[model samples]
Target: MKQPLADAPASDAGRLQVPTAVLPLAFGVLGLVVAGAALALWVIPAVPRLTIIGDELVGLSYIVAGTIAWLRRPSNRIGPAITGAGITWFIGDFVFVPNAVITALAYALMWLPNLFAAFILLSYPTGRFFSPAARALFLTAVAVSAAQYAVRLFVLDATGDYGCTCRNPFAVLPNVALYDVVMLVTRIVVVLITLVTLVLIVQRWRHASPAGRRQLAPVLFAGAVGLAAFAADITAYNLTKASADAGALGVASVTGTLLVLARTAVPLGLLFGLVRTRLDRALVAQLIVQLGQAPSPERVDEVLAATLHDQTLRVIYWSPAARAYLDGRGRLVEPSAGEGRAIRLVERDGSPLAAIDHDAVLTDDPELLTSVTAALALAVDRGRLETMVRAQAEDSRSFPTGRVTLLYSDIEGSTALLDRLGPRYADLLAEQRRILRGITREHGGREIDSRADEFFAVFPMGSTPLAAAVAIQRRLRDHEWPEGATVKVRIGLHTGEPEIGDEGYVGMDVHFVARLGSAGHGGQILVSQAARDANAGELDHDDLPADFPPPRLAK
Candidate 1:
C-alpha cells in the first residue's frame, strides 16, 4: 500500500491530537446562545433602557471578537480571555432576575467581565503578562473588583433604586454609608489602574517594531475609545443622580450608548488586525521549491533565513548516534541561552530529525514555522542519513584493512607542475584528483587512502584495477592541460592476502605495491606478476599500447 506523504498537514494532524478549529467553534456557538438569552430576558426589561442596551451590546461585541480571534489563532490566550469575558458578561444579566438569590449571585459576578477585559488589554499581542508592573496591575484590578463585589453582596441593599429590584439574600448588614465609601474607593482604584494600563500600552507601542506597531494600532485605538466612553458615561450618570431632567437623561443615554459601542470596538479592533494579516504564502511556496531541490544543510538554513526574513537563523541536526546537536560541519552546536532565540524541533514519527534556531518573533506566527518545518522534513531526514553515512565512513577510515588487490598511484612530476603553474596549479590538481577518484570508484575500487596528488585504493580481483589505470592514462592524455602545467600519474597494482588493520593494508604486499608505483615513469602502469596473472584471461592485448611495457617483478 502506498503511504500518505508524511509532510502533508492532514497526515501530520494526528501528532497534534486536537483539531485547531473545534474548540473555538464550540466556544463561539456557546457564547452566542448565552448572549441571545441574556438580551431577551434582561436588557429589554431593564429600567434604564439605553444602559441595558449598551451593556448587552458590549457583551455581544466581546463574543464576536473573541470567537474571531480564537478561530484565527487558536494557540493564543487572547481569544479565550475575550470569549470568557463575553460569556461572563451575559451571565451578569442574571442580576435583572426577580429572585433574591439569583440577584445576589448576579451582582457578585457583574464586575468579572470587566476584570477579564482589563487583563486582556494588559496582555495584548503576546497574551501573557510579561512584565512585573503589568502583572502587579492585573492582580490589583482583580483585588479591587473582588472587594467591590463583596461589598455590594454583603453590605449594600439590593432592593434599592440603584439598579436591582430584587432583595439581597446574601446581605449581612445594610450599611449605606459603608457601601458608598467602599464603592468610591473601588472606583478610584479602577481609574488609577486604567491610567497605568493605558500608559503601559503606549510605552509598548512606542518601543515596538514597525510590524508590531501595525498589530497594536487597531487594538490601542479601540481601547482608548472604550475607556473614554466609559469615563464619560460614569461622569454623566453621577451628574444626573436619577434626575428626571430631559437634558440629563439625554446625556446619560448618549454616553451609555457610546460606552457600549466603544466596548465592542476593543474586540472589533482585534478582529480587524487578525483579519488583515496572514502567514506568508509566497515564502512558503519558495521554501517548498527550495526544499524540493535537494538542499544541503547550509542551503536549507539559507532558505529558511530568507523565508523568515531572519538572517541569523541556524539549522542544527540531531545526531542520535552522537546524542547531540551538530552543525553542518559535524561540530557540536550549543544553542545560545536567553538570546531572544527560539528552537523549533522538527520530528518525524516521534523521533527528532532536526531543530531550527531562529528569532523569537517567529513564534507569534507558529503556523508559518510549522509549515516551513513540514516542507523541510524530508531534507532534514536526508541530513540525518548523510550524517550517519559520514560517521560510518569515518569509522571505516579509522579501521579499514582487508586482504584484497591494492593499487597505489602518484603524480610523476607534481612538484614541478606546481612550480610551473604557481597559483593556478591547485585547480588542475583538484581536477586530476576528481578524475582519478571517479574512474577508481567506477572500477569497483574502494579508496583507502588519499594524499596531495596520490591515491591508495583496494579492489576485487580481475582486470578492474588495470582497466581503471588504462582509463585514467587515456583521460589525462586526451584532456587539455592548463596553460603552463600538465597532469600525469604513475600507477602500480599488486595482488596479495594482506592483513587489514587500523591505518589500512599493513603487510609486505602493501609496501611492495608502493615500491612498484615509485619505480614507474609518468603515464606508466607497473603491475606485479600476481595481479597480471589474476586478470590474465580478462586482459585485452589491444587495450595495452605497443609503447607500454608489461608487468615487472618488485624485488
Candidate 2:
C-alpha cells in the first residue's frame, strides 16, 4: 500500500493532530483501490466493478486535498475550487448511469468542470503535481471525444440501428475524417504538453534538497505510477477496437487512483523541506567570522581576501611627515583597482603603514568596526603612557644660577606637529630638545628640559638676555631641516631669574622663568624689562639699553 504523498500545514501540525492524518488515509485508499482494481481488471466485461468505484475513489482524493487547502491555505483560491469541482463531477460519474447519447454527453460535461478544478490545484506547490489544468484539459478532451459516442448512441436509440455486432456508438459520426483529424491533433498537443510537464517535474524533483526529495519521493513515485498507468490505458485504447476496449475502463480506473498518489507528492515534499534546517551551522559560522572581532593584520587580511575577493575595497593610511599615505618603504603609495575594502594601518610611532583591502560589507559590520576601534584605542593609550614616562626622564635636568639670564625655548608648531605625528609625535620632540641644546650652548649657556617640547636655559650672570634671544633666532635660521618641514623656534628671556640649588622640581626662579618663556612665536623672542636693565653695561645707551643682546637683536 503506497502512501498518498501530502504534507500538513505549519499551523496544522501545531493546532491539530488530524490535519496530516489524511496522508495515511490517502495511503489506505490507495491500497484498497489498487487491490480492488487489480481484481476487477482480471475479468472481461467487468467494467462496472472498476469504473464507478475507481472514479469515486479518485474523486475523493480531490476532496481531501481540497479540504486541506481550504483549512491550511485559505489564500489559495484555485486549489479548493478545483478540488470541489473534481469531487462533484466524480460523484456525478457514479450516480448517473446514463445509457442514452444525451445522458452520456452530460456525463462527459461533468468531467470538463473538474478539468478547471484540477487547474486550480496547480497553484499549491506541495511535492505533488497538483495541476488541475491538466485534468481540466483532459476532461475537456474526453468530453469532445465523447460527443462522437453520444451521437452514435442517439442514432442507435432513434433508428434501432445499433450497426454491427461490435457497435461503437462513436463509429457513426458523419464524415469520420474531420473528427479523426481533430482527435488526432488534440492527442498530439496533449502528448507534447505532457512531455514538457514531465520534464518540469523531473527537473523540480532533481533540484530539491535531499530531505525535500525524500519527502517528495513518495509523491513523485506515486505520480510516476499514475502517469504510467494513464499512458498504458491510452496505449491500450488506441491499439484495439472500441468493442475490444476490454481493459480500457479498468485501466482508466487504475490510472485515476494512481493520480491521487502522484499529485499528492508536492505538499508532502514541501513539508519535509521546511522541517529540516540544512547547512545552518555553516551559515552561522560564516556570519560570525564576517561580524566578529577582527584579529591581527594577517588574520584580518585573510578574512578580507577570502570573504570578498570579488568585491571592490581599498583603504589608505595618513602620513604626517610626508603629509600623505606611506607604504612599507616610507614612500607614498597609490591605490589600485579591484580593491575590495580599504583600511588604513597607522604605525604606532607616527609612521604610515600599509593599507588593508577586504570586502566592504565585512568592514561595514558595526560590531567588527567597534572591536577594532576599541583595540586601536587601547594601543594608543599604552603608547601615550610610554611617551609620558620617557619624556619625563629625558626632558628634565640640572642647572646652576647667579643672576643668570633665563631663557625658555618652545617649538612654534608643536601642537599641530603632535596631531600630525599621531602616537609617535612624542619621540619627534626629542629632536627639538637636541636643537635647543645646540642653540643655547652657542650663546654661552646651559640648557635643561622644562617639558616635552619646551627647553629652559640660562646665560652666564652677566650675559645679555637679548644675546640669548638672538642666538635662538640664528640657530633656527641656520639649523638643517628634514625635507618638507621647517623647524621654527621661539624663545623668551628674563634677566632677573637667579635660583641655584639641588631642589630641581619648582622654585620662584623657575616660576618667573616659566612666565617669560610661556609666550609663543616662531623665530620671535621676548626679553623682560629686568633683563634689559641687567644688560645696560653691554648695551649702547648712556644710562641703559631697553634690550638684551642689545644691538644684534635690535638690528
Candidate 3:
C-alpha cells in the first residue's frame, strides 16, 4: 500500500476531540447556559442592575475572548486557563444565594477569581512561567489563597468579613479581632505579590527582544492597567476601613469600578496578542508580491527585514562550491544567531539552502517563521547561484596558481531524456547537479560552473578529481529515478596550468577538458595522462579504466 503524504489531514479519533469549526459553537452554547444561570441567580437576589451588568460584562468578556483565543490556537494553554478563570468568576456569584451553606462556601472561595487573574497575568502570551522567581511567586499566591479559604471556614465571622448573615458551619472560633488581623496580613501579602509581579513584567519588557516586545506589548499594557487599578482599589478599601470617612468609601467604590473595567481589557489584550502572528501574515502576503520583482540579495535582505519588522534581520545564501554560507558580497558568514537574535533555516528537498537570522521573538510564532522561510526558498536559491559565482572567484585567489586538475561532467542523452520526460526532466537534472556538486565538495574540489546537464570543477593537482569522477558516476548509476528513468553521466579530468580569470578558467586547458569529456561514452571517466601522472600512486585499476585514448583538444 502507498503511504499517505505528510500533509494529508488526519482522521478524527473520537468526539472528545472536537473539530475546529465546532469548537466555537460548543463554547457558545456552554456560555449561554452559564449566562442564563448567572442572570437567574442575580435576579432572585434583586441585585442592582448596574452591579449585575458590571459583573456580567467582566465575566462574559473573559469567556468570549478566551473562547476565541482557544479556538485560534488550540495548542496554547492560555486560552483554556482564561476560560476557567471566567467560569470561576461566575461561580463566585453563589455568595448571593440565601442558603447558609452555599453562601458560606461562596465566601470561602471569593478570592479564587483574583487568584485566577494573577495566574493569567503572570503567564500571559506564552502561558508558561518564565523564571524560577515567577514560579515561586505563583506558589506563594496559591498558599495565600488557600490560607484565606481556611481562615474563612474556621476562624472568621462571616458577618464581619463579607457583611453576610450566613452561618459558617465550620467556624469553630469566630474571633472578629483575630480575623481582621489575619485578613489585613493576607491583603498586604496579596498587594506585595501584585507589586512584585508588575515589576517583573516591566523587567520582561525591558529585556525582551524586538519580536518579544511586540508580542508582549498589548497584553502587558492591559495587565499593567488592571494591576494598577487593583492596587488603587485595595489601598482605597484600606483607607475606608481605617477611617470612618464618606470620601474614603466613595474613593473605594470608584476604584473598584475601575478595577472591573481594567480587568475586562485584560482578555481583549490577550486575544489580540495571541492573534498578532496571523495579522503578520498580511506582511508575508506583501512579501510574496514583492519577491515577484526578483530582487537582488541585498534588496531581499531589506525586504525581509521590513516584512518581519526586524531591522537586524539578514538573508545568507548557501554556497555549494565553498560548502558554507556566504553574504551577497561572497564573504563567508556564520548563520547561527547571537545574543538577542534567532535563525530560521530554509531548505529544499531536505537540503539546507539558506538561513535567516532575525529577532529571537520571531521563533515564538513558528507558523510565521515557517511561512517566511518557505516564501523565500526560490529567491534564496536564485541568490545562491550568484553567491556561488563570487565564492568561486574569491576562493581561486588561494589556489596554487600553478597546475590544477579540472573535471568536467555532462549527462549523456540529456536532450533525448528531456524529450521523453518533458517537465519531469528538470527534477532529474536538478538531482544530477545536487549529486555532482556534493561529490565535488566532498573530495575537496571547488565548483567552477554548472549549466544545464553540465558541471565544471577544479581541484588541487591530486587524486581528488579522479576520486570525485568515480563517485559521480557511482552516485548517478545507483540513484533511483522516478518512473524507472535511466541516467548516465560522462566525466573528463585533466591537469594543466589554465589562464585563471575573475570569470573562471580559460585557455587551452579549459577547452581541452571540455573536448576530452565529449570523447567518452556514457558512464565513462576519461582522464588525460597529465592528471594520472600528477597522482600516479593514488590511481588504481579498480578506480579508473585501464585504457585511455590520447588527449583530444578539439571538439
Candidate 4:
C-alpha cells in the first residue's frame, strides 16, 4: 500500500467516506438555502406591504438541524455549520421582517449570539479551536450584534419606521418612539461589521499559506458575495422598487451557493485529493490504466482528481528514508519509516494525489511493486498529456515545434478546392487535426501542440531520438490524409534545438525545421542547416530552398 507521509494527519475514517447522514444533511441545507433565496427575492421589494411568512419557519428548521447536530456531537463538523447557517439565515430574515413590529425585540434576541458564532465558524480554522485573530473577530461580532440587539430591546416600547430598511410592521408608531433608537444603532453597527470584515480579508492572499489561504480564500469570496447581496438588498429596500427584488434575490441565491461550494465543496475536494495516498501501487496503477482506456479524458481526470482528493487512508509512495516531491510553502516533506504500516500520514498542501491503502499482496516481489508504481505514474502522465493537448488546441489554430518534424499537410489550393469540393470537404480538413493527435503517441511521438491544418510532435525521449524520428516519419507516410482532396504535405526534418518542456512544447527548432520542410517541392523532406549538422555531414537533401545555404552533409 502507498503510505501517507508524516505531517499529514490520519483521517478518522479509513477512506474519504462521508457517513450516510451527511448526504441528507447536504440536500436539506441546499434545498432550504435555495428555497429561502427564492422567497426572499419574491418579497424583498414592497416587502413591508406583505409580511414574511413561512420563510422564517423554513430558516428555523435549518438552524434547528444544525444546532441539534452540534448538540449531539460538539466535536463533529455539524455544529459549526449549523451555527453559521442559522446566523446567516437570520440576517436574511431580518431584511424582510419589519422592525418595531411583531415583538421587535424578539428578532434581536434570537439573532445576536448567532452572529458571534457565525463569525467564528467562518473565520476559524477547523483543526484547532479559534486563533487569536479569529477569536477577536468573533468577539467583535458579539459586541456589535449584542449592541444592536440591546438597542432594539431598549427602544422596543416606542415604534415607527425607524426610518431604516427594516420597515416595522407597525409604522403606526411615531418615528421618535423608543423602538426607533434601537433601529438606529443596529444599522450603524451592521455597517461597521461589514466594513471591518471586508478590510481584514481584502489582502489575505498576500500572507496566507496555500492551505491557510485555501481556507481563507473562501471566507473572502463569501464576504464579497455577502456584501454585494447586502448592497442589493438595501437598494431594493430603499427604492421601493419591484424589479430590484428579483435581482437582489438572485444575487443572494448565488451568494448562498457560493457559500455551499466553499464550505462543502472545498472540503469535499480536499477529501477527493486525499484518496491518492491510500491505495496500493497495483490498485492505483489499475485505476490509472483504466483512466487511459476511458473514452473521455475530461471524465477520467475529474474522477481521478476526485478520488485523489476525497478518499480516506490516502497513501503516498515514500521514496525511501528521506525524499519528498511536493514542496509547497509551510510544509517540508521528507519520508519517514512506517514501522509495520505502509505509509505514515503526511502534512497537507500540495502533495501528490493519494492512492488508497489496499491490504492485498500487490506483488510478491518489491521490485515488481516498483514497476507497477512507475506504470501508474506513466498512465497518469498520459492523461495529463491529453489534457494539455486539448488545452493548447483550444487557444490557437497552429502550434510550431522542432522535436518532431513539422509537416503542413495542407491540400493544394484549399480555398479553390473548398468551393469545388464544398463545405462537406471542410469536414475532412477539420478531421485532420483530431485524427493526428489521437494516433500521435502510438507513432512514438506526442502531438505536443496543434492547430488547423497542422499538428506538431516531440519524439518520445523514452526511445532514442533517431529511432523516435524514424517512427514519426513512417507514421506520417502511412497516414491516409484526407481522401479525394489534393492535400499532400511537404515534410521538414531538423534535429536542432527545440524548446522542449511539459506538454510537448518545442520552440525555435520546430520553426526552422518547418520552414525547411515547407520549402523545396511539395512532396519531399526538406532538411535544414541544423538537420544537416545533426547528420554529421552525411545525408544529401534534394529539397532545399533556392536562397538557402546547402550543407556538405553528403559524405
| Highest TM-score model number | 3
Q: Comparing 3 and 4 by TM-score, which wins?
A: 3
Q: For residues 6-31, write the lDDT of model 2, one tens digit per residue.
A: 34678865766564445444544553
Return the top candidate by lDDT: 3
Clashing pairs in 3: none
In order, candidate lDDTs are: 0.71, 0.46, 0.73, 0.43
Off by over 4 Å in 1: 1-29, 42-57, 64-76, 91-104, 158-167, 209-221, 228-255, 273-283, 290-334, 345-355, 376-555
Q: What TM-score would each prediction reach against the true structure? A: 0.56, 0.32, 0.65, 0.36
* Alpha carbon lDDT at 457, candidate 2: 69
**Which stretches of candidate 4 lie above 4 Å from their native place?**
1-79, 82-105, 110-131, 158-186, 206-219, 228-462, 465-555
Choose 1 or 4, whichever is better by lDDT.
1
Model 1 lDDT tens row, 151-255: 888997764432455667778988889998888777767767777888888797777655456556877778877767666665665666432211235777688
| Candidate 3 local lDDT, residue 116 | 70
1 versus 4: better TM-score goes to: 1
Q: Provide the clashing-pair count of each candidate structure.
A: 1, 29, 0, 47
Model 4 Cα lDDT, one tens digit per residue, 51-166: 23433443454455554444434454544554455445444344444444533544445454345334534443342333466557657767767765665555343433221345
Superposed by TM-score, candidate 2 places the C-alpha of residue 351 at a distance from the truth, in angstroms, of: 44
